[model samples]
Target: MMNPAPALPRLAIHYCTGCRWLMRAAWMAQELLTTFEKELGEVALVPGHGGVFRILCDDELLWDRKIDGGFPDIKALKQRVRDRIAPGKALGHSETAAH
Candidate 1:
């Protein structure tokens, strides 16, 4: 018998309408989905307020705009998500130098 693979993580991106974070949030979602298509279960866009921009994976908070003092770099965000959901996976150039 072989061991089963872990369940794919669910990512939720919450962006504030008041701050016009839709494009940023959507772009991040697109990048994550494209990069981790097979590893991620889903990426949900959630509307929010008060300059809120957060990324949650499997109900765990991964990034926060206000808390982190600004938006996250897409590559960094990918690493963060990958660390939690697919620790053994490599992000290739995204994790290399010059970033």
Candidate 2:
């Protein structure tokens, strides 16, 4: 049987106080998008009204919630990113759980 196609992913970045953090986050998110494009396909990271945001698999509420550690928390952000790239699988699933 043919499997259903995975839904398109979406990202939303809530507006924060300054552009420094948001800008950095946006850049990092873009890098992630490029890396995951082969698997998860295209992804988006946008700014909203309170903080930065990113699409989880297809969730658009990532921006609504505050992200801990801010921009420096690339590890945490990457985890959330990996979650979207390979929902059930771990980051770099082919190898160890962590990548």
Candidate 3:
């Protein structure tokens, strides 16, 4: 018998509802979904407070706004997610952009 395909990774974006960051979270979700449609199984927006903003892949922390000192631009975010899910994968122009 043939083995089934592995389950794709799940990403969660926890944004501060009190801070009104839902739109930002939603946009990030859309971006990740568009970029990693095949690699990612789902992108969930998790409501949070206390100025929280974080991205996680299968419970692995990818980005933490406070800990990281600031929010990552989409290019950096994509690099972070890609490093977690598909290391060494090409990110086209994002790869060439300065860090």
Candidate 4:
């Protein structure tokens, strides 16, 4: 019998087309995929409307632009994903440069 495949995190970025946030969404996805190349299963870009911009790791909400009051900067975003998927993982310059 074949062993079951390992479960991996799937990330989704939902950005509003009406608000022209696709480039931002795509860029974030690129950053995440490059950062978590081994830890993640997939990253999906989901088109949305009404100024919605969100990031989800599986079913867990990572960021919501509206409720959070603004978009998350790259550093904050990288830290958020790292915290959820690989706690204690160092983010290199992304973690240290600001300090």
Candidate 5:
């Protein structure tokens, strides 16, 4: 194992309504969280206010990403999370919370 990398950036994903894709997205978020922890230490992938899973990092603005479309929308979601984390880094790592 290697020492954790510098704090690249923070990311937060928010899902508003309860939908089938919501859970799917949550799983995807989990996968991202595990994969990116090396570059972005102490990241958070949490289920937001309304059963909405969110990924929170240093960038507070990222908390506002509300993805409506499911599954296929993951690409966009990943982009947004990547944008929030840092340009070069990837996504997958998250801090989970039930809401």
Candidate 6:
């Protein structure tokens, strides 16, 4: 018998509370949840500090604001998460728009 596919990954969005990035972090969480509803197990919003903003999947770091030097574009962020969780999935308009 063939083995079943692995379960979906858990996503964590950590944003700097001191920088007041709650809205930005929450918005990205909402976008990811909406786009990958079927493939994601959960999305957690974590409060952080020192202008830190990061996205992690299954404990692996995906994005970091300090390193990237800015907030991620919504569409680009979606594509990055999709690439990890559901590689074959399409992201509709998010994929077509220029970044």
Best by TM-score: 4
Candidate rank order under TM-score: 4, 3, 1, 6, 2, 5
Which pairs of residues collide in model 6? none
3 or 4, greater by TM-score:
4
- Model 2 per-residue lDDT tens digits across residues 2-72: 99997655544443445445665567667666656656555554555445443344653433234433343
Worst 10 residues of 3 by lDDT: 90-99
1-94, model 1: which lDDT tens digit per residue? 9989877889999999998889989999999999999999899999999889999999999999889889999889999999998899999999
lDDT scores for all predictions? 0.93, 0.52, 0.93, 0.94, 0.52, 0.91
TM-scores of the models, in the given order?
0.90, 0.51, 0.92, 0.94, 0.44, 0.89
Cα RMSD (Å) per model? 2.6, 4.9, 1.6, 1.2, 9.3, 2.6
- The true-versus-predicted C-alpha distance at residue 31 of model 5, in Å, is 2.6
For 21-88, candidate 6 gives per-residue lDDT tens digits of 99999989998999999999899999989888999999988899888778899888988898988999
Query: How displaced is residue 71 in candidate 3, in Å?
Result: 0.8
TM-score of 2: 0.51
TM-score for candidate 6: 0.89
Instruction: Kindly list the per-residue Cα lDDT of model 5 for residues 1-99, writing each as its tens digit.
Output: 999855465554555445434565567667556666555554444443554545455645543334533233445555666666556764433222225
| Candidate 4 collision pairs | none
Ranking by lDDT: 4, 3, 1, 6, 2, 5
lDDT by residue (1-99, candidate 3, tens digit) is: 999999999999999999999999999999999889889999999999999999999999999999999888999999989989999688888879566
Q: Please identify which of the two predictions, 1 or 2, would achieve the higher lDDT against the true structure.
A: 1
- Model 4 local distance difference test score: 0.94
